[model samples]
Target: MYLSSVSRPASADPPTPGRPGRRFALVSGNVVALGTVSLITDVSAEMVAAVLPLYLVLGLQLSPVAFGVLDGVHAGATALLRVVGGFVADRFRRRKLVAGVGYALSAVAKLGLLLAGRSVPVIGAVIAVDRLGKGVRTAPRDALITLSTPPESLGRAFGVHRAMDSFGAFLGPLAALAVLLAVGQSYDAVFVTSFCIAALAVVILVLFVRERPEGGPPDTPDGPKVSVREALGLLRDRPARRLVLAAALLGLATIGDGFVYLLLQRREDLGLRWFPLLAVGTSLAYLVLAAPLGVLADRVGRLPVVIGGYLALGATYLLLSGPVHGWPVLALTLALYGGFYAATDGVLIALAGPVLPARVRTTGIALVQSGQAMAYLVSSVLFGLAWQLWGPENAVRAAAVAVAVVLLGTVPLLASPSRLVTRKVPR
Candidate 1:
């Protein structure tokens, strides 16, 4: 099978193969360290994310429009920063340091929530700060994973990392609930505890993660430092550009998970108490399937696996339209939803990794991610409007149609090496 363009430094050895005596010997040590950090950090971030909407909407009593604006900000405000963080990390060859800075910024923002209290503007600002840190850290962290692992095992490595990340997501809300129960429903205590956990994640990053060695071939003059212009020029490559476009297109069709669960709840007349459990179900599926699906992608191919994921998503939207109902539909939809994330989330980045030059891998990944985030913000707004005008069922049906169109287009765009490849230049 033809391989994608995986540009690793000549000096850096390929990732080690699985060993009989060593557990997880197939995966690199860096991936494990990063995954551990992500697991702890996600526990902290998800704790706040699970409750921030309630704190803003019910606690502060913001209007729907105002809350929607905050949500949009939470989703898309980091678009530019993602590019900046990626570019800076690539330029300085300090992926771990940049990632750590982002992690630190997020850890500190947990405390900012305490100071914000019930003030709407303050809360919005704090949320934006937290998202900004996520924006900054994500690309650099993903890039580190790509650079540190072998191309052949990229899917498995990312799968393992995302599974760990999803495991944290599954636990975060439970952790918050436990804190609330213990502390007599004190949000402040939750915030404080979250900050402490996040700080520990930062410590893990500092002590364990190592930056990959930089510099290309010995003969290459370390290719001029990656500048902003070069970073922007990343899309000039055909496959890279197509990948970005496809990601955005798919993202535009996808609505937020909250909306999906709300529809199911309304259809089933589910109790308010059980609403949060919907997310837990999906996270559980994701945690279970991420690693296995990733390994499947490595053994088979990433493109087909990614397409299968969106197909699962389309099925989810269709399921919401009520051809099927009750617990069976809910269970199937949640499983598909989880499968969608397992297939696409890390796999998309892994697909992008080999197609990009190592020098600007972070920037390229950030570009793809930012495009999708911006599209998702737009999609959320559009879906909300569609729901208001045409009702939830029709809106979801339309979304299913959109996903179908994009998924079909993406299949060919990323089908083979020749299509994605344009020209390889000395970096």
Candidate 2:
């Protein structure tokens, strides 16, 4: 259905011959606003994301294969939107406006989950809307983050932004866990809470965040210099190429946490409530590590940070595949999983911005994100099918093997930013 639409301010039509960069809130303001929304949204999302597999499997009796099919379809649904998001962001040049719409779409996704009936496919469709919002917003959002910051400190800016963004991730699941404790463990409570948070994110973004006037530097050598084809063509650089390739491979091998939770549930050994709590452990670890890891990336290099994240995540997949049983194993694995997300997700976005123009920055992020989501789409389906065909450990093992292979292949190509990507200045 339709969300309450927001009208965006006019595109930066050459900034009217010298409208000063008005010492606005873009850098700090945008980050803070985005963080607030993220925190609220995460409170909603983590509630759902944390226990979605349980909803699919035990609550609905869907097989691992069916879950995979659903996950794949959900991820792929988002894939349809990135090109549109990028093209729209570039064409209308209304990055902030497009972003507002994205947040609303994500918020609505949670509502869909609550309405979903007993049918497995309906649930998948609900998840699909949720993820499509992710696809749409991601590019435009990153593009705005880039627009908000000073050129030299893009890494630091994005990192701090990431750290703040992840704070919500930490709280969201805890809120859900609280819901489970207080309101009783039903899907409706989590879904409605998540939807509320998503709506709150929209309100915060709309009111507090502002756009830089048009003809903004790097976005324009004079004015939006690059064509869509040229923007897409920039990925031809070796580092961009490697990063996307590595991202795609990682995506192919990687399984979402939802699938992992299902595996835990499928074993029939753990308490029903344990999964969300374990998810809390994961989100908390991610929140704790996000800032520190982001700082480490700024100090050492994004490549090292990113590579380490991949290795750690690959190992986590291996661990989940192994005989480590009970809450202890689950707890540690969840923590590492969060750490993996904390380390890589933002840093990669940081890495991406400098490599692309302000105009096309979102598109670049969209492209890689789209790739990863595509991998998720493919991996979930394949992984679920394998789990059904063989078993959970075997399915996980197969994913781990793919991860290990890609990691070894990409490590040699890693390089520092000065060499890897070209830096741009707002003209």
Candidate 3:
């Protein structure tokens, strides 16, 4: 229903006095506060994520098929709820409250796992609950960031936020490992510690984060009050609609990260002992590059950066099927994979920030995210089936091809209609 005022970088309003060159200062305090919340929450969440598979498959001796189904549920069960959460937040104008509820739900779910004992169904439910919290909080939390920062610096703001988030992800497994060693590998100890950490995150959110008022004075109207219908109607806008579809299409071409690591192990015939290190390498790369990439996206252009990230992903797929051997392949592929994440993860949302109205921002973002998540679910299944039917090499090459085609198609869909979309593509 609305368009960003500028189609190119030069037309953008100059940064407010004392703002443009000041990266951290230009970023809103809300972003840093949320980033801290994410860092702590991710550590708690990741601590469990790092150990849950081992506890389920090895300790409980569940079949691979059962684990696969549970894994898919864990990853995808929250997709639709994301829209619900976003809509609720916008409708009530209570984003912080909605996000807080999500955080509390996740914190409590950590304790639920401890009570679930060895029961498979109970454990599955607990995991689902935890994921639901993640889904619910994500859109509102990101919406807060967009509301807090200037539109021009959205990329850099998201970058710093993601960097902090990635840092937590990097620390999570390590924290789990330390807890395990400290408590003789007791899963209950890890769960309790995770709950404590998550609870602390909730406390930080309540104490530090401030919510925008429901409506301002007569002289200053906050955009129209958002309704569920208006939120959904965001799709009526051409640019927004294209962004949603393009995100889903791009996501369809992406198989999950685990598959990439597994392929690397299979290709190199790497030892079981080194399997975990593959993830570590990728995380290292992501942590190192996320912030810089964000700044680059802000400076260069978000669309090009996003496309470049996907290109990095396609290249990673190609390298997996390439003739390269030994450590070089491992290092290069992992770096490219990390680059892919750095480029697209937050950048995509940052790209979407200006396209949709502030009134329905959370809902619009949730729509884009839900599409990607659903497509990712289908993509993972399709890739697995392809691997079985055509073998890993063929399956991977097909993925690379799909990524190339999607990238080409997406460029035009995302292009601004006014002109050649120079330094900053239109919102």
Candidate 4:
């Protein structure tokens, strides 16, 4: 498939001077293959995500605090495993294999959800298993993209991948809605269909995605083994440390998509059936903006783009809490939320890709991702508490303030030009 078609070597090739299209033109076939895998996987994942909030809050009658805990667990359940997955992939030079395992685990977890029924603990456990699969797969998958693409075009590469991924996200909720409508609100059918689609994604990964693209990062059989100490040593680098800290801070400022959508649904008094469409709105905006913003990040510098994303996030939170009513608020909030994701998600990883050593690249990415996930867990819980204590409006407003504070704090951490420079970690 795509693996055989790309004849060009994958070594970092600086964009030709004055070539306007060089940035995206440099994105490799391997990146596209990986993106396809992510696209399929997201379709499977987002199907569950689209309906989960309503299932837990409305069907199960969970309080905000209980829902918060489950949501936090959903995000952070595999934080430690991400590092393990990354280290294993790096050590064995089997990124594709590790990623496949994670994918399979998540595909099976879909069935677990079917078995869990209405039991909260069981549902939480299933969610954790699903998230664990995500945690395991994410870093290695992103590392593969970085390894496949040139440093100069990393932004475009990740952007292209995320855009494809968002396209699937855009489709997923619609698919779920269709399933629900067809089967008379049968979540089981959605789960089964999701598993089938997820299984297909795994098959695609095994067949189409190359373990190592031609001229990609060195992972020769004779190369020195990647060690735990070496993985930990990534933090010793100033730029890498700052990047991870910045990522965690950014995560801390953010709340879950479920919360945002739920808040909107409450404020707008949207019907239960229309809930899934809210995610579709966000994903549609994400699909449209992801690639353009990525290209912009490469051109203007990633930090500014990332900062702007957080600004969009703050605006989204404000809109949720603000007095603005009717469809305009919903449209603007969803757009800004989607823009926030488009601006930050892949771009931050692309920014970090150039800073870490090739051998520990997956581990480095995992560390960054793990930190962010852990913080996201805390953020979700805190936001939940805020909602319970201060009510939704005050809670969302506080979240907006938090975003502003974190953005200000992040600027100084990332302000040093040297903080983003590529560095070699000694053996």
Candidate 5:
């Protein structure tokens, strides 16, 4: 088995009684480097995400159902590849290299958008390619964080990392808006610029991020080899199985960001130019709350934090369909939406990190993520169908109800006593 020590800075102070030592000790240099990479990469990814709904729905004149299919594809196109990437990273012990390849692929896909030139199928293909990169990178990248951080600090470490990532998400829409205004609403310019930024992120990953921290277990030929059977066997582990099931349930309750923003736009009659800013509001809230909520997860419990996040999601959907009008609804919905992401995104992974063994940690993370992605694909399509059959208002209200039902169902799965224990993989 591959064993590793948590990477802490030499300057880190030991925890003292009555001191805020946990706060200071939670993040390490390796985590910061990873966060920086995510920060830049999200800026590139979100720029496209911010504008794509409008481009597809209004610019391309696609129906809600078509957009939903495309959106679902965008989210889940490479779900299986998440497992492949994780297995590759674990088997080769080349996490950074795998993640870098994923980033580079996403960067190149931005240029693919330029070549697609308004063909719906071609655009869908490009979006799938872009999401493939994300699916490929996410597990290995998250595993790197889990490997480097102490089990106790996983929540805070992921929190800090996500906050930085959310900062990039926060800036991306503004950047897109600026480019669109400067270039006279030319999406090609936005695509070109996004490509450049994503390329820069790949460079940073290659230069700054380490495959594993120093003084940890070296990647050696003699280490126990990971196997496909072992990866599949993760489901036999009760905690891992529950986590994956819970993740899928949560994912099934979520409609994609595009639908939420588009609904907000239609309800408010917002101008086309203001649409990108809707993402900014959510990202801003996520950026501010991610770290704090992460720390809260560590102090309280991961399950509660995750449950709270789902509650926020439920509230956000209700606000969308509620009778309340004007800026208050928008602001509240965005804030709740952001809180939903902040509380759940990294925290759920952190919840899993401790329970998984070191030997196939990446594979375990990939399973959880893949389950969610696959379920999200279904949710998006169903939501689109609902929007078409029943109006947006009725569809959103149904979604809120679904969220509540899922939350009630998931609580028992995640709250089981066997779910949170840290596993000690034999060496």
Candidate 6:
């Protein structure tokens, strides 16, 4: 089978409230139910990771570049896994099983962290392996999400999924803050708790979640076999080809979300770690706005959401690199930051899904995510280098500038998402 332009199959775990048949019947609809499971899991993870850099720097005595190096390895591993996992999902028809395995592995990694000694390399290796499973699981799980949600309601379905994911994101940091406050910012305790939460997420997947539009056996599904030539040919298709190109451009331009946290870290250096209370503020904002934004994009246009969102994000970063810091400033920045995530993430995923040939949906999603992973490697490395040379705040300013340039350059693409979006599928 060939690697065609990748498609996003619907995987970002969020609580999808039952969409009334106003659009299409919800498939597993339990996709939203599973969002809760993910939320619980993330709460466990965020607490540790939110302050993980501090652990590395304060506890491990690493440098900013080391932080970047770790980030690159994590993203790089996850990114490459997406390419391989997509093919497996498409080939074996075992999307759900793979997803289950991925979650189990991630949970195990978290558990391993609890047992490991003060060996930084060992812990880092475990995190990388755990992320390897994430790479394996994400495409198939997303494919399942897309497969489960009917075509017409794709935007809402993904929106719900992202919201759930974001909610988990919110809880993770908040939980971390609580742990730090209670136990004096102990990374080990954070790791132990996160392991338990991850365990719960895996349990829910095994017990409750089922793959939708269920395909073939784990060995192989009965679809047009994808040859490498066929995969390559997906790029030659008109809009599918164009959509993938646009995806690559965005991927190249958009910097790592980790940078945003780094920006928060800088604020901490500026005497504002207490300012991450603003992260909570941002999560709340995402909670309020994400679904509505999803519904809005469905009614208006995906381009408006994406292009406008990018512009807003650029402005948010610019403002962040401005005189912003402390409680008031951090709150404002994170509010827009979370909004930036809410506005763009689901819309981009929704836009990509409809444009590609259905047969290569798994790979199409993989391609976009892979492109993102590659970009993370580039941007994160650049950001890290800049941070080490110039310091965190200035490097962030550079990233914001780069984003503005990309946002402006990509404006032309948003003008005609209709051209890229495929004709409506049969009801």
- TM-score of each candidate? 0.87, 0.85, 0.85, 0.93, 0.92, 0.84
Judged by lDDT, which candidate is best? Answer: 5
Enumerate clash totals for all models, in the order shown: 0, 5, 0, 0, 0, 22
Instruction: Give one digit per residue, the lDDT tens place, for model 6 in 1-427.
Output: 1011122323222323454443544324566756666677667656656766656665677776766767766666578678777777666666778777777787788777766666778767887877777777776766766666654566677678777877887877778777767887466777777878888888888777776543211222455677666656666765556655566666655555556765765664643355335456667777777777766666666667777677767777677678745667666777887788788777777777655445566777777777766776677677778888997668777877887777666666544444543333233
Q: Is candidate 2 or candidate 5 better by TM-score?
A: 5
lDDT of 4 by residue, 1-427 (tens): 1000011112223223454444446577888899999999999999999999999999999999889889999988689899899999988888889999999999999999999999999999999999989999999899899877656667778889999999999999999999999998889999999999999999999889998785444445477898888778888877678878988898899889999999999999999999999999999999999999887777667777888899999999989998879998899999999999999999889877766777778898998998899999999999999999999999999999999999988877765544343322111
List ranges where model 1 is wrong by over 4 Å: 1-24, 56-67, 213-223, 421-427
True lDDT of residue 2, candidate 3: 17
User: Residues 32-67, candidate 5, lDDT per residue (tens digit)?
Assistant: 989999999999999999999999999999888999
lDDT of each: 0.78, 0.69, 0.78, 0.85, 0.85, 0.66
Off by over 4 Å in 6: 1-28, 115-120, 213-224, 268-278, 324-326, 413-427
lDDT at position 220, candidate 5: 43
Candidate 1 weakest lDDT stretch, 10 residues: 213-222
What stretches of model 4 exceed 4 Å from their correct place? 1-26, 215-217, 422-427
lDDT of 6: 0.66
lDDT of 2 by residue, 140-220 (tens): 877777666543344555666666666776677677778878888777888888888789788988888766633233355
Clashing pairs for model 3 are none
